[model samples]
Target chain A: MLIQRLAIIGVGLIGGSLARALKRANAVGEVIGCGRNINNLQQAVELGVIDRYDTNPAQAVTEADMIVVAVPLGTIASVFAAIRDNLSAQAIITDVGSAKATVVADARQHLGNYLPRFVPGHPIAGTEKSGVAASFAELFEQHRVILTPLQETDPQAVATVSTMWTQTGAEVIEMSVTHHDEVLAATSHLPHILAYSLVDTLAKMAERTEIFRFAAGGFRDFTRIASSDPQMWHDICLANQQAILQILDSFKTDLTQLITAIQQNDSQYIATVFSRAKSARDKFCG
Target chain B: MLIQRLAIIGVGLIGGSLARALKRANAVGEVIGCGRNINNLQQAVELGVIDRYDTNPAQAVTEADMIVVAVPLGTIASVFAAIRDNLSAQAIITDVGSAKATVVADARQHLGNYLPRFVPGHPIAGTEKSGVAASFAELFEQHRVILTPLQETDPQAVATVSTMWTQTGAEVIEMSVTHHDEVLAATSHLPHILAYSLVDTLAKMAERTEIFRFAAGGFRDFTRIASSDPQMWHDICLANQQAILQILDSFKTDLTQLITAIQQNDSQYIATVFSRAKSARDKFCG
Candidate 1:
């Protein structure tokens, strides 16, 4: 087995999917889930996502060779602190948080001697849905998993985490913690912010009813991310505040230029921006 | 057949799809296509999207009982003028433009005495992909077709256009020309602007490669409309300038508020906006 006694703290969509995927690959011997929701934990056990369930973080990580911290970004520090004193010296630790610079800093502050064994990761896979019930074994198939290992982190620990993700059918990529945070801020976090803001703005308009009634496939696809978990996104915005704000500022500047072009009917300027964006989006995005 | 002779000017995605859907339903006979690209027109005929092809709009509309002007919004005036004198006196004319008020004005200026027979309609359908190659008979299935018929427009002409849309399996609704423009600005036009702006902003950043490389499903779905035809959108922005500018102002206000909330780390404000948007999006959009 690739992992013996794998403990998943805050076992929601990300953690549950990891456990299910590892178990399906026959790469994990024992899976223990810990979460705030008792019913969810019970459901996870019944579905074979975990071999057992625990309520205490200290007890969940007891003798676990590997521990996965899959909580929201705001709670990552506390989660790290809770299991720090309970982990074996040889144990390797990791997290699946979207923001990485803060996670790496939190690990430095709370992981104590286990800092070198901590490998931070963010899997670029998920639906708008949350919780254990929404997870599946093939969630990471053909997906990318980014790992951000700090300078003090052990190479062996990074390799172990990389192998674990590879076993789940994910392509593992490594980058600096700061780069991960900044890049994610531009791509994922900023899009969520824009989607939420646009939807809220439209909902408050006098033509809200008719606007939604006549919306087509394009608008639906454009706002699909607005249905994401608000609490999770709230934490993300605050955790990656600096990088997100920087990218958000850039977007606003470009938006201002676009609005001005539209107002003045500068067809050439507007077309240039739209054409460039179309080329980039078609080349890079799905 | 519901239409004996139908002429489609500027036969592209919208016009080709309409022709294909009507022919599939046996609702039209002797469909003739006209466009700047002779190869595209020939391909339309080969795919059975049209029964014949014509390079001249005036000749294409000769003796035709119904004509669908499916050109870009900026070209709508010229296309109307091209066929105005050649159309049969009893011919019913309609358009598939996204913006309605400008189209109504264009019809008034160029359609001559046929203004009463002009139906200003917008089919709430289409993908980012353009041209007849991407067109399909099922494109309008389960979609909406909004018809903004003026007071001077004949009820018989409106009924004929509505029946044509209905035969394509689309639900047809009628509204004022002004209302259609405003609502479309919020739901469709505004979203496209935001998407194009965001993609352009990221592409201009120094970290463009990394930003796009890490873009996940959410970003892909959020920016899908960024790949839409730039010329069409350029025409739309100018044609629907007033409404788009007004909605764009509202979006900017909300976005500025969101940026401030993120900067201050105001958890409650961010959460409220995201939550409200999630609920509204889940309730209204797919």
Candidate 2:
């Protein structure tokens, strides 16, 4: 087994799925799920996603060989602080957070001596759904897991976390924390903000019900991310604010150019932009 | 059979799918596929999406009892002009265009004596894939077909068109052309523009390859519409320019508020906007 005892803080979709995937792969000896929600932790155990459950992070990580912090961005520091004094020296800590810079900063601030063993990570896979009930063993299969290990972090710790993610059927790629935040801001965070904003704008209008009633498959797919958990998104927005704002500004400039082009009936401009975008998306996106 | 001979202009996804659906329901006699591409039309006939093929709209519509003009918005006027003189007196003409105002105007300009028999329609359905190869008999099943009949248009024409759509298992909803365009701008056209712009913006960035490499399922779904036909969206943007620009402006205002909220770390404001959007999307969207 790659892991003798694994402590998974925040037994939600990502954490639970990781545990389940590891168990299915026979790479983990024991998985102990810990969270604020005792019922969810218990459910994770009952579902066999974890070997046991703990309501306290300190108690959960007491004898664990590794800890997976899968909590929302807002709670990263607190979860880190609570588990700091209890972690074993060899215990490699990694996260499944969407944002990396703040998460690594949280480790530095609250992980104490264990900061060297902390590897900030993000699994580039999830549904709009949440909680242990939404967790699946194949969630990370064929998906990418990005690791943004700090310079002070132990190389062995990074390798352990990468191996663990690989056992869960994810392809692990390492990059700097700044690059992770910026790229995710452009690809994930910005589109989410646009979707939420678009849905809210339409819903607040005079003909909202009618507008939504007649919405086609395109609109449904476009706004699907708007159905994601708001509190989680709230934390993400705050954690990744600068990068998101930068990309948002870039998008705004582009959108303004489109507005002017359409107003001026510049079909060639619209076509070129759209054609380039289509070719790029077709080439890059699955 | 409700139609003695059904003529499908621009026998691509929507048109070919409609023909397939009607044939599956046994609602039409002879199906004639017409488009500029002789190869695609020949393939449609070979695939049984249509009984025969014609390269000219005028020749294709001769003696046809029902006609579906499924060409792009930019070519609606030309297609209507081409088929106007060849339409039988009893023939009912309808379009499957996205924007109804320009389509109604196109009919009025070109259909002449056939104006009363013209019905403006949009079967709120599609996939990113196009052509007869992508068409299916169930493309419109359980979907909505919106018809915007003009004042000078015959109710019998609308009824017949509605029944034909019903035969394809679509629920027909009728509204004024103005309301349809405005609502569609918010729900459909504006989202397409944003997706195209977002994808184009990211693809233009210095780290485009790495950014796309780390993009998750959320990004994939959010930008799925970006992979749609560029020429179709180009036509849509120009045809529905005014309404699209208006909703886009509203969306921009809301987006600005979000930017301000994120920059200022106004957590409550961001939470409120995101929460409302989630709730509305959960309620109104499928």
Candidate 3:
């Protein structure tokens, strides 16, 4: 077995899916799920996602060879604090958060001498759905899992985590925590924020009902991300504040230039911007 | 037959699709496609989207009972002017443009006495693909078609256009030209501008390839519209400048509040905005 005992400290989609994948692959001898929601943990156990369940983080990590924290960004610090003293000295710790820099900083504060074992990770995959019921073994197939290891991180720990993710069908790549946070802030976090803002602005209009009724396919596709979990996004925004703000500033400047072009009836300028955006999007995402 | 001879200017997706739908329903005796590009018009005829093709709008509308102008918003005035003197007195004219107020104003300037026979329309349907090859008979099935009739428009002409759209399987609704422009600015124009701006900004980053590679499903869905036709969107932005600028200003205010909330780490404020957006999007576009 890759790990004798695997502890996942949040029996939601990410954590539950990982547990299910590991169990199916026979990568772990035992799987333990820990979370604040007893009902969700119980459901994970009943669904065979975990061998057992625990509400206490310290108890859960007592003998775990690997510990994965899959909670919201706001709770990462507390999760680290709870398991700091009880975690086995040899256990490799990791997390599946959207933002990595904040998680690495929190780990530095809580893990102390055990910091080298903590690797901040983010899996670039998910649906809008959440909870254990939404978990599936194939969710990470062909997806990327980025690991942001600290300067003092042990190579063996990183290798073990990387192997475990590979077993679950994910390609793992290593990068600095700051760079991870910056890239994700631009690609994921800022899009969610913009979607939310657009939806909120349109919903507040006097002609909202009719406006939505006539919204074309383009509008529907563009605002689909606005339906994601609010509390989760709220925590992400705070955790990746600096990176998010920088991208937001850049986006605002581009938007303002577009506004000027439109106001001046500068068709050539407007066409240039849209053409570049279309070619780039097609090249990268088509 | 609803129309004895139907002339369609600009046989691209919208014009070609309308002709195909009309032909499928046997609603028109003969359909004629007109455009500056002879090759596209020839392609439309070969696809059986039109019975014949012509490069001159005036010649195409000589004996036409109904004329549909489906060119880009930037060319509406020129198209109207081209056919104005040759249009039969009994012929009814209409256009499928994204912005209505500008088209209506242009019609007043070009159509003169023919204004009473003109109706403005927008079919809320399309794929990212364009041109004759992308046109299909069922493109407008279950889609909405909004008609903004001028004050002096003949009720009989409005009824005729509504019946034609209904025959094409589209639900037709009526509103003022100004109201149509304002509503579409909020729902469509602003979103397109935002998508183009975000994609352009991200594509210019030093780590752009990696950023695009790791973008999750949400980012892909949120920026799909950025791959739309640049010249078409440029025309739309300029055609509806006033309404677009107004909505953009409002969106800027909402975005500024969100930025401030993120900077202050005001989780409650962020949650409220995101929750409202999620619920609103679910209710409207779910």
Candidate 4:
């Protein structure tokens, strides 16, 4: 099962960057891009990210041995519906969506038995920028890519998808789709939501303009994820709302404790939290 | 007058780093260090961060032409009290404390009319690591050093302190002490608190060990500030409780809005927040 021909749906930052990286590695023989925007398709072709471009999802799916759906989470089902009948029997399709359970469920419903070959993955790598112009070869290097393979997934098929991602320089870890959503909701999804909300709240304040001017390097870095594509993040928040809400509740509890410590001038409690956090970050992230 | 002799109180990260940078720039004729910890004083001398170490605050202040208080916020008043009558009348004094208003207030009450020459300053630069070992010459270069000077502050004294910080490659900005705290609460203090709290929350999660194992670059960068000194952060949170609590309340409200949007599947609201945040970050932080 050599992935000689690859079709990338929604050739934006993640998808476009993957195509660019694959092309740079020359891992695949032919790459075709499919997108709703003709200008984007043309620009992707001009950028040499794809060898060809097509507006029709059906036509693109018919020729490729592998397909990557890189659209927002809300559109995952429609995307699958559009390509369901045209996908080759041997085609190994995957996605770069942030949420996993809902995407995997959609695949199971739409593609039926072929869902086994549908590897739902998320590469935990991105920049503040978006679109084909922002794509780069090293986008996924040394990044974690969690693959949520359904119980019905074939071992051989999972291995094939894992190999494809490995070639793109991502370290793939397999996890239950539900677990993936829960973990991401804690680590990635909730963080983005918090950053976005913080930005909005500060922007509405009386000193909004000066607020940004005073945002130190830490604030800038903490809020960097808020710069992600709005539509994409919006789709993720809605799609993974339950998990996100649960994580938010936990975060609020933690924040409330912190606030209480500060208000009560509990220096000891504050020190304990700071020490625990520092040690955890150093041991794991250092 | 030439700074033929200098005294630095509480030789930790800021004081030690300033000593290193001053040495590199060939600005000081002699450096004397004072601290409660005899081992830290010895380490500062061993690391060449000071020319001499003194456990007696009176002896350290009496022999120096200038003094820099680098101790914790709560300890600043005691540092002044220990050296109040022992100081040389010509000796210009400054502090590197994070909160300016409290220190300024302390200096006013403790030193009386001598307070006009006591400049309250903060170097807006640091790393998570601290102590004498973490001191480096280039730490303050290209960074901002804010001075909170009152109406009673002498112009010559301000100029001298400004010149010293400038020589170390920092751009000095003058502002009111209260304004400094307010701006910094949004910029530095709040961010550190949030980062530490976020890390603590994640660390306490059941599967955190595993989640951290897969923590990517973004997570590492986002939580980097959490690894700062626990005692330092504890003192800061207690000293700057009012502003921090106000900002935290605002942050919570914004977070609630985002959670609501996600729950309702309001893609438009989510995208708007993300886009606005992205634009704000790019405009201010780019």
Please name the candidate that would achieve the greatest DockQ relative to the true structure.
Answer: 1
The residue pairs in collision within model 4 are none
Q: Model 2: which docking level applies?
A: high
Candidates 3 and 4 compared by TM-score, better number: 3
**Which residue pairs collide, candidate 2?**
none
| Candidate 2 lDDT for residue A54 | 83
| Candidate 2 C-alpha lDDT tens digits along A177-277 | 99989999998899899999999999899888888988888888899999998999999999998899899999999999999999999989999999999
TM-score: the better of candidates 2 and 4: 2
Residue B244 Cα positional deviation in candidate 4, in Å, after optimal superposition:
1.4
- TM-score per model (chain B): 0.99, 0.99, 0.98, 0.96
Model 4: per-residue lDDT, tens digit, A1-286? 2478999999999999999888777788898999899999999999999889889888988868889999878888988989988988888889999998789778978987678778888998887678999999899988878888877788887887788778889898989878888888878876677677777777677877876776666777777776777778888887788888898888889989989988888878888899999999999988
Q: In terms of DockQ, which candidate is stronger, 1 or 3?
A: 1
Candidate 2 at residue A242, lDDT?
88
Instruction: Give per-residue CA lDDT, model 1, range A15-70, as digits (tens).
Output: 99999999989999999999888999999999889999898898999999999999
Among the candidates, what TM-score does chain A have in each?
A: 0.98, 0.98, 0.97, 0.96
Number of backbone-clashing residue pairs for each candidate, in the order shown? 0, 0, 0, 0
Q: In angstroms, give how far residue B38 of model 4 lies from its true place.
A: 3.6
Q: What is the lDDT of candidate 3?
A: 0.91
Model 2 misplacement above 4 A: none
Local distance difference test, per candidate? 0.92, 0.91, 0.91, 0.84
The pairs that clash in candidate 3 are none
